[model samples]
Structure formats: structure tokens, C-alpha cells
Target: MWVSSSAFEALLDSGACACPVRLGQRLDPSGEYVRRYVPELARVPGDYIYEPWKAPIEVQERANCIIGRDYPAPVVNHLAAAQRNRNAMKELREMLQKAPPHCCPSSDDEIRQFMWLSEEGQATATVGSN
Candidate 1:
């Protein structure tokens, strides 16, 4: 669900699964106006949000779009977007690092035997494998 998880849950809560405005890949509120002009489709290497305003004029010119005069203002303020991404990534990293490592009670030999159809099959396969 990406960032739309909350909105999806809201729709389910309201029993409005078929809500018309609940469009997937929905157009920006500003509509095709954004697409017709330059869209910073993605963030550059280090930056999280595509904030055209902060980009150098030379960089914008190289990209073949003028800043302010050419591209529309970012839908949300860049500072806010940057903060949101930073916090989200931080939380996610913490969650992942806290996840438990998995281990089985069986040893490597036991695992190999368990995977085989029978002990005879395991012995035969294990002989060839080794």
C-alpha cells in the first residue's frame, strides 16, 4: 500500500471500498498540469524528495527545465517531505534490526535427512553429495 495504507484503512472503515476518489496511481490534485511541465520524477542520489527549487539553475537548465518559471512548485514543501522520509526510514530500520534470527533445532545432517523422502534415500543422496 506504500503511503496509502492509512487511506485504504480509512476507506475500509467507512465501508467505501468503491470510493470514486480512491484512485490508485491517482493524478496529482493539480492534475495534468504537472505532467505537461517538468516533474522531478524521483529524488537525486542523496536527497529524498524531488525538490526542483533547491536545484542549481545550471542543473535545471541541463535537465531542460527552468526552475519556478518552468516547473510547478512541489506539491508539498520540500523541508516537510525530507523530514517525513527521514523519520519513516529511521523507524523502518529500527524495526528490521529488531527482527529475530531464525534457527532450527535440527543439525545440518538432520536437516539433510529430514529433506529426503526416507533415510535410505537420504543416505544415498548424501553419499553422492559429499
Candidate 2:
């Protein structure tokens, strides 16, 4: 079931992560969603649309979309982003471990300060101390 970041953090704090959390992995490597919004990559091949940076110059010519010219290079590498998120989660969990005992965040403002919010509004993890 879907849960907000604060709720998910509460679950983790309660040691419920023993069951798997459905952290996302790469899907739609064809960039279907991306292409729908980013018209620059629409002409890109199905193989290269998801990884425009990896598209060779020849493919760029064929697609008429140059990486970094027609379409901006991905601001963050996917693997790097994933790793960063994982590290942030680890740090948050550690921070939670050291948090003042018997104190729990109650308000949305309080809880948000302890979580990471992606540009897409996905709450990835808790961050910062009180």
C-alpha cells in the first residue's frame, strides 16, 4: 500500500522494513514517459531515448537530436541518484537512532524537516534532526 514519507519513516522506525519496501528500480528504459513530455527526445530511438547521453553521434544524427544540444544531458546519473537516495536513507535511519528518546514528530512541518522531498514530490527519506 502507498504511504507518505512520514508514515514510511514511522514504519521503518518501528522495524517494519524487515518486509520489503518497494523502492523503485529502473523501468520504461525506452523513455516513454520522458518522451511524452520532452519532445526533443521524441525522435530518439527506443534504445537511446532513455539514455540519450549514451547515444553515439551517428545515432544522434539519425535521430536529429543531439544529446546536450537538443536534449540536455540527464542532470544526475540514474545509478548515482539511486546510490545517493540509499545513502540518504541510511543517514536518516542513523539519525533516527540518535534522536531524543520518546520524541516523535507530530506535525507535518516537523515531519517534513526530517524527510527528503524529490522535485516530483516523492518523499524518499527522513533527514535532519529536530
Q: What stretches of model 1 exceed 4 Å from their correct place?
A: 7-49, 78-130
User: Which portions of model 2 show Cα errors greater than 4 Å?
Assistant: 1-8, 12-32, 101-130
Task: Provide the clash count, candidate 2.
Answer: 1
CA RMSD per model (angstroms): 15.7, 11.0
TM-score of each: 0.27, 0.54
lDDT comparing candidate 2 with the true structure: 0.61
User: Candidate 2, residue 114: CA error in Å?
Assistant: 19
- Model 2 — which ten-residue stretch has the worst lDDT? 16-25
